[model samples]
Target: MVFLLFSAATSFAKTPLQPILPLLEAMPSDLHVTVPYLLSFVMADPLKMAMVSIENNLSPPETLQKLSESLTSLLPLLSQLADIIPRDALLWKLKLLKSGAAYANSRLHAVQAEVLFLASGKDNLLPSGEEADRLFKGLKNCRVRYFKENGHTLLLEDGVNLLSVIKGANMYRRGRQRDFVTDYLPPTLSEFKKTFDEDHKLFHLALSPVMMSTLTNGKIVRGLAGVPDQGPVLFVGYHALMGIELSPLYEEFLREKNTIVRGMAHPMLFGSKYETSRQESSRLDTVSMYGGLPVTPINMYRLFERNQYVLLYPGGAREALHRKVCLMSPYLY
Candidate 1:
């Protein structure tokens, strides 16, 4: 879904890769041909870049060489994409699109929901401390969990956990002992062992595995010392890098802290909750079992009122596509 948009919009946008004029000239007018053609090219570059990084330890010359090659390769794909949409149209939209909410400040004070501000200290797109502080002050009831060393994608980054912050403290005072722990059932011991062994092997090969160390202000956090041992905590944070950090973040929390974060996902994830399908999909089934509900104000409110821990990335797809450096936010998200 994202790659297709990238292909169509790259010609006019300030993309990392430049357009390939020859490929553009050769492309058919049909989008069907263009999408797969671009996809074919996208598949190889990341692995190639990773291989170069691992082999050369990301030395400047080697890295630049790989980058140049990758960009050169992308020319054909972008050229093919430009056939479907004019570069000028994409450029115009990119320039005019609002990156954030303009009227949020005026409306936020009217919100009665207890706010949990999860701020990333080194966030690039938004100043984490400043934004969190602003929200904290604006809202009638709010508490903050500041990660001094993390960037915008704090949860996705290594060594951070939702459980680490919300384990003990009664963050919100809801009268009933609403135990929605059943909404999040940790994987069985056997299931966990199998998943861990598989993920350990996979991430090592894919990410060039490294030990995770949670730090606060350059000091190591050994246990739940930084977190309040409590219930019904909701974590609000920004999304980054297409929310690529989610799987690792969720996996780590389950593995180390024995907690499952009920991620409030987009409605698309559940495949039309209103409709019933006789044809079962393994992918959708797995996601449903993982406890990803459609995002709604009611869902969030109920979770908090019930004393269940909830994780939210409010930025949606816009934030994920807001790329800057290395498909990541420079110095932040």
Candidate 2:
């Protein structure tokens, strides 16, 4: 009797009996042949049975329903271990192991917009592209591509290729947009003509010996010079030696020409006690009567409205006295 029992146990050991048997049983002849033939029954008999008993005793549920739920959860994990151990031969010796399912779940949720999976040939941990593909399977809108002849630190090794890939992806996304081109030819031509006319007037003024000599030496020469006498004209020039040199020249030019030139002086000039005195004030009032507009913030806006010739220094003071030798370029606003 003991010999028969031992033989039955050996057969059962070689085949791993299902923890939760199927609700529908197999036919008697089918079960007898298949169950005994399984390799797991031959190799994992007494030890497996002992382990199962111990597991059940330690992890006993309060209710039958809880036991069923526990078995359901464990079966998938056991199957995963069986699959993993054979493929990854190094893990075959491990009898019990924990999975990274929780970590994997966390990674899946953390993915927001996109993911870049970079794999290298030399990396021992993830040598095959299959591992990276498996991990990214759960991710939505994720792509995986391999870098040939590159190792674990692929980014460092293949920086140019990586950059090319990123640029290509960006170009692909941006190219999907619709492009509209409208004709700006008429407006552009009109603006060009107006600018050309203004440039021609400036070119003529620049040739004047008084204007040229005044600018060359550090003397100031401010005046109104434009067509349509009282129309809106901008008198652009260079200034040197603060307001001392410029003020007298501006007064003289306006008085001689009998044309209003609104000189836009810096606030610093007017803020001075000497320049803002009663005597100077009287002189400025006299100049104002003979067509000189002393540009204050209050009257500057109004002067422009009346189509008056306005004098302006684009550089203010910084560019005017930048160095002892002046550069030949106009200081643009």
Question: Pick by lDDT: which candidate is best?
Answer: 1
> How high is the lDDT of residue 99 in model 2?
31
Please, what are the lDDT tens digits per residue for candidate 2 over residues 270-326? 222232111112223222322333245555566666676677666664545555554
| Stretches of model 2 off by over 4 angstroms after superposition | 1-227, 243-252, 272-299, 320-333
TM-score of 2: 0.24
Clashes of each: 10, 9
lDDT (CA) for every model shown?
0.48, 0.37
Per-residue lDDT for 1-333 in model 1, tens only?
000010112122222223543354444545434543454443333333233322234678977777677656646754565566554554444344322243444466677765555666555434556665565566665555565655544554544434423321122122333232333444455444433455444853675433244455556565443433354767666775666566665566565656666777666554322322112122333334344566778887887776666888776545755744342322233
Candidate 2 residue 36 C-alpha distance from true site, Å: 99
Per-candidate TM-scores read 0.35, 0.24
Distance (Å) between predicted and true CA of 274, model 1?
12
